[model samples]
Target: MDPRDWLARNTFHHSAFQDLRRLVAEKERQGLRLSLCIPTLNEEKTIGKEIMLLRAELVSRYPLFDEIAVIDSGSSDRTREVAAAFGADVYESADILPETGTRRGKGENLWKAIYQLAGDIIVYLDADIKNIRPHFAYGLVGPLIERPEVRYVKAFYDRPLAGAGGTRPSGGGRVTEILIRPLFSLFFPDLAALIQPLSGEYAVRRETLERLSFPIGYGVETAHLMDVYRAHGLEAFAQTDLDRRVHRNQSTGDLGRMAFGILQTFLSRLRPGGGAEALPELHAMLRQFQARDNAYELVEHHIVEEERPPMIDLPAYRQRRGLPP
Candidate 1:
């Protein structure tokens, strides 16, 4: 059967398993352990409420998760304090596994969380989600725990994007619909079924996660999908529709930067051997100032973005496929 048909048959919605009690019991019977991880950065406004609700309703009340941890990217605000106050095991990304020198990114926090928390399965939830609910965790984790074949479960939000006029009822960020999806379609078509390709919410098996190398930045999500798909194939992926996820609306400038980073990461994989069409030269230069004695020197760092080859184009892979290089 084609991969799309497989996804249509296997893909699920969060509402499909609303009975958390049953889901928890099913997991216990199978002896599956789960962990909840939230990677934060100056998310004080929403962090407290998220930690409290998830821990209180899911961890403390239903014992749905084995551990709930908040891995942070050194926030200037009281993000850590708020999360901790709400009973979350908060740890700075830099503090965990100090040997690996900390970096400021969501992936850095998540990567650190793997080393700090212990669980057979890990469910990552974004801290900025405002309409936070237990379903966010239970829904994403349910499929993986219930079905051993499902190694990775991605959460798809049902929110209507502003000005989209419901044409795109199931909305995702600009990068997701435009760049990520098209790239995946051209290369790893099987992965195109993931509705929210850039969604921060997801659940994955510990073994699968430990074996993969995280990009440690915006590339993390893209890297995860590509890496996991390579290792486990399309059958291992599942997307669940989680009703709206309310979060801070990013400014266009911020979104552009995000899209640029993701594009660089994706293209780096799709390049090499003249793979994919040549893209227009994109610029990413930053202006900075250097302090010298009592004076300051204005400087500019010209970030010349380039790309590398994807694994599919390697000479070894071509040889294995009996294709002429």
Candidate 2:
């Protein structure tokens, strides 16, 4: 399909799904169970509000979500406490799958959520959004609940850029424009239509999600888009315009490490067999410089883009979901 045609049909705005009553009616009519998963590290400041607002609106007021869970990556801060205090069902990522062991990353929490939560459709939202709102959850899930054909719904925000005439909507952050977009345009042009492919917000069907491998690092989101598009094509994906999102920005050095990790996952997917095994051994160390007392110092960050197998492949997950093992 033409990129423009796909965008025209699949793209939507948050306001389009603002009628909570109608969304709930459709959800019940379809007999769908929704789960909201907020993946966190040290987000005590923001997690509480995110849970409070979402639980009050999506859970209490509308009854749209069956469960609102916070899958924490063992934060030393009060993130888990605050989340639990705000009426969210919180679980430590390490505790969910003790037999498989744990690796610290946002993706690990998300992978574990598929096993721990009981929703047929899982909506993942980052815990660091300062401007928390209900549309963030409802908008992403609306497409999946209403359109059975759409297996994944990604969120995009308006980051205005000044052009020759005036300001217009830009794509995602630095790494998205500089790296992910160009890479998608070159190899997977259909996916390039995604306004913010790297956005840390999306809702996916359990059947689709359980069948996909997750990269437990910065590469998780990137790998998901590639794998889903490869298996189901662009037709199965949808994107929503969330208006604006405010959050802390990462420095160039931090983005460099993210870029490095994302690149490793991207290259691995390009191989014929398409998995971690397909790629040759890669150096996990990322070398950067830091200014200390007006002098430069070398810093090495070990960022391995490790992966978790599809949830459906696990006997425990199958048993938990009451599927025949």
The lDDT per prediction is 0.78, 0.92
Best by TM-score: 2
| lDDT of candidate 1 over 1-325, digit per residue (tens) | 3777867866787777778889889889988889999999899999999999999899888888988999988899999999999999888888876755666677777776666777779999999899999889988998887788988899987743245454644546787888888888888888887788899999988777766666666677887887787777888888887878888888755665566667666776566543655876545664556689999897655433322223234454335435578
Q: How much is 292 displaced in model 1, in angstroms?
A: 28
Give the Å error, residue 43, model 2. Answer: 1.2
TM-score of 1: 0.82
Question: What digit string (tens of lDDT, one per residue) describes model 2 on residues 226-263?
Answer: 99999999999999989889999999999999999999
Q: In model 1, what lDDT does residue 242 have?
A: 83
The list of candidate 1 runs beyond 4 A from truth reads 159-171, 271-325
> Against the true structure, whose lDDT is highest?
2
**Model 2 misplaced regions, further than 4 Å:** 159-169, 273-280, 293-295
Show the lowest summed lDDT stretch of 10 residues, model 1.
303-312
Against the hidden reference, what TM-scores do the models get? 0.82, 0.94
In model 1, how large is the Cα lDDT of residue 257?
59
